[model samples]
Target chain A: MSASRHRLGRLIGNAVLLAAVATTLAPLLWMLVTSLRPKQDVFDGALPSALTFDNFSAVLHSVDIGRQLLNSVIFAGGVTLGQLAIGIPAAYAFSQSRGRWSRWAFAVLLLTMSVPFVVVYLPNYILLSEVGLLDSHAGMILPQVASAYGIFLLRQHFQAFPRAIVEAARIDGASEWMVLWRVVVPASRSAISALAIFVFISTWNEYVWPQLVAGAPGMQTLSVGVAAFASEEAGTQWGSIMAAATIACLPTVAAFLALRRQIFNVLLEGAVKG
Target chain B: MAPALLLFGAFVLWPIARTGWLSLHDWNLVSPDREFVGLDNYSELLGDPDFHRLLGRTLMYVAIGLVGGFLLPVGLAMLTLRHAGRATGVYQTLLFVPTVITTAVGALVWQFMYLPSGGPVNELLDTVGISPVNWLKDPSTALPAVGVVGAWQNLGFSYMIALAGLSAVSPTLLEAAELDGASGWQLLRHVVLPLLMPTLLFLATTAVLHALPNVFVAIEILTSGGPAGSSSNLLYDVYSNGLRFFRVGEASAEAVVLMALIGGAAVWQMRLIERGVTYER
Candidate 1:
């Protein structure tokens, strides 16, 4: 009886998991199907009867999707690079410093993470406008460069680094920068990869900041571009919108799939320790 | 250290301080000088019924999302944990795809799905002998519909976190439970959940925060905070007041309220998290 009950429990568990998987993946599958379907057949929903690339073509041609895609790529790339450039050194300093001030600074960084984007959006807009950087890539990327989460993650990884290695490198007369690059970075490949994936995905999918900062058509990122298509007053053109969305989602999805292990590791660590 | 501190001070801290200062004045986009308004914004916000409604809506959104988006995802993660095999990675990837999609895109896709006529959701309902329901058009259903989308988008992230927490559970403990003839439900309740409390707390807090900001997106896309501003949340109120109506002072006051609420919640969560986390030496 106990054995049978165990088998029953296992069966139920598998069934529930499969159901969860289906529920989670169904909308994405629908998105792909809708994107590939001909425009008129989107509402018809009989597997399109004849799948076509027309929606993707229309989305690309009718919209300034190419320019928008480029803008998004540049913005995302710039933010990722800027954050790494600034965050790495800061994280290193925080890790190496042995003072109450550093500890207090770290706490302040943690506190700042709770400040929502809305709180900063208005002031940043005004500041950027005053500096003639509004609606520019610099404006888009600069404010987001100093990420508390990135600094925190990198600091955690740096703390886990072998102090002996850094000591030996210093004994060899290596500079701090050289030790950071040659010793710490080389050892923390997983953490760096994880942070990169996280940052890329976030910057790619970010909406509100991009919407507010990059209002000009030429400066708009992919998220805002797709949002424009969706929010238009014309009749809902499901196929084209889905196609645009699919295109917008491609880069991040590709990145996530490519760095799946690293992403999972970072998420796992964050979940356990966050 | 100097370089890092200088950059942070110039960029992050200064901007935050500037926002606080800006909130105290009646400022505009093009204005050279700002009028001094000492707590006038706060008083005006306290008197506004719309702002109160939006705060209530935001609270409701957080509540619904915490249960559906946050807890449901944890449950799904636990379910996924039972199947630790080669295909688990595939499942994880597929499930997390929605999270990478932009909120605008997810809202649009779901809007199409929830269309009263010719949408798959309604068609499925018809097959089960139920009449179609207008999901987004109705005020009562709009917030919940958007909440569902939010849940769908966040399900993967929450699941991954919970799964990671579950992985840290010692197999020896499970084996011991089995030897003691503890049933599946008993093992889950008595052993697994207590051990997973820290992860759960973290997930819950972050989920609430995520949900609060997201109400604005949902309002913007689906309802624009309307059918008479029924779906308006604190963020949307801030946006509407500041951007739409050009009422910077009122918007600043609304924002102050939002900041206070979120800050309070964060503090409460930090305390809970500090108490809950158990370090294994």
Candidate 2:
């Protein structure tokens, strides 16, 4: 009797889970279908009987999606590259610093880890505008690159890094820079790429920051581009908005699928420790 | 060290201090005229009913999000943990793919889906022998609908956390419980749940923070905090006020208020979690 009961429970569990998976994916499936159908047929269920790329072409040609795509890459890629460049060095120095001042500074920096950037966005906007970076990609990337959490996370990972390895590299006649590049970097590539994936994905999805700073159509990220399309086209141009959203989501989705392991590692680490 | 210190001082620390200073002034962000107003913006905010409603709604969204957010992910975690087969990988990917979608895109997708007429959701409802509901149009239903999207977007992150918590749990404890004739329910209740407290606390705190600031993309895109501003949160207000209206002083004041609230909550979380976590071993 117990064995039968357990089997029933397992069966019920599987059915419920599969249903949830379908529910969660239904919207995306609908979006893809809607993006393909012509304007008249968008509301007609999950699959399009007829498929066309006219909506995609309209967004690209009339809506200026190509310009926005370039801006998004520049902004998100710039931030990703900049954060890695600065964050890795800062993290290394922070991990190796054996001094009182650095420790005090590190403690002070930790306070900002959970402080959401939204709080400082206004002032930062003002500063960026003052520096003539408003409506520019520099404005978009510069403010985001200095991440306290990045340093904090990397510091933890670096702490776990074996020190004997570094000492052995030093004994092998490698300079500090060479040791960092040839030895430490190769070892911590996973953590570094994980950080890159996060910064890039989040930046790609970033709406408010780019909205505030790069509101100009030529300079905004894909998110702002799609949002502009939605706000204007939501009522009458449903198919186009669907197409634009698909365009905005495609890259991040591709990245996530391609770099699945790295993204999962970062997200999993954040869930556990953060 | 110099680069990090310079960047942090220029951006994070200084922006905070400047925001504090800007809160005390009457600057319209463009004009050269800067008049000092002591505590006026904050005082105005305190008396403003709309600001109060914004705060209340933000708290409500977080509260409502927690209701489904905690239960759903925890349930998913347990369900996923029950089996260790290859199908688990496919299920995990399907559930997690939403997390990769841009929040703006996610919001747009849901906004489209929630259309009152000719929307797929309405069609599904009609087929299920229930009349269609205006998910985002009605004020009473709007916030919860928006909250559902947030919960969906975050479900994967939360599920991953719970799975980690489950796996980290000692297998010997489970075996011992089973050996003592403890059923599945009892094993989860007595053995697994207690060990999962830290994960819950972390989840709770993040759920609140995510609702406040991180949810703006959805709210901005979907409703624009509309249907009589039913879905506007504090951060959305900050964005709409300062950035949209160029009301620098008022927006900066709101930012400061939000920062203080977040700081206080973080301290509370540390205390709450540290007490339990310190003695766990």
What DockQ does each prediction reach against the true complex? 0.60, 0.61
Using Cα atoms with residue i matched to residue i, what is each candidate's TM-score against the true structure? 0.92, 0.92
Candidate 2's displacement at residue A52, Å, is 2.7
Q: For residues B165-231, could you state the per-residue lDDT of candidate 2 as single tens digits?
A: 6656675575455445638678768776787677677667766666666566778777778789897
Taking chain B only, the TM-score of every model is: 0.84, 0.87
Clashing pairs in 2: none
DockQ-based class of model 2: medium
Clashes of each: 0, 0
lDDT of 1 by residue, A1-274 (tens): 7578767766787777778788777777888898898776787754767788888898877789889989888888998888888888888999999899899998778777787776667767777877899789998988888678788888888998989999999999999999999999988887887888788778888888888888788998988988887767244788888888888878788877887888877766554565
> What would you estimate as the lDDT of candidate 2?
0.80
Predicted complex 1: CAPRI docking category: medium
Model 1: pairs clashing at backbone N, Cα or C within 3 Å: none
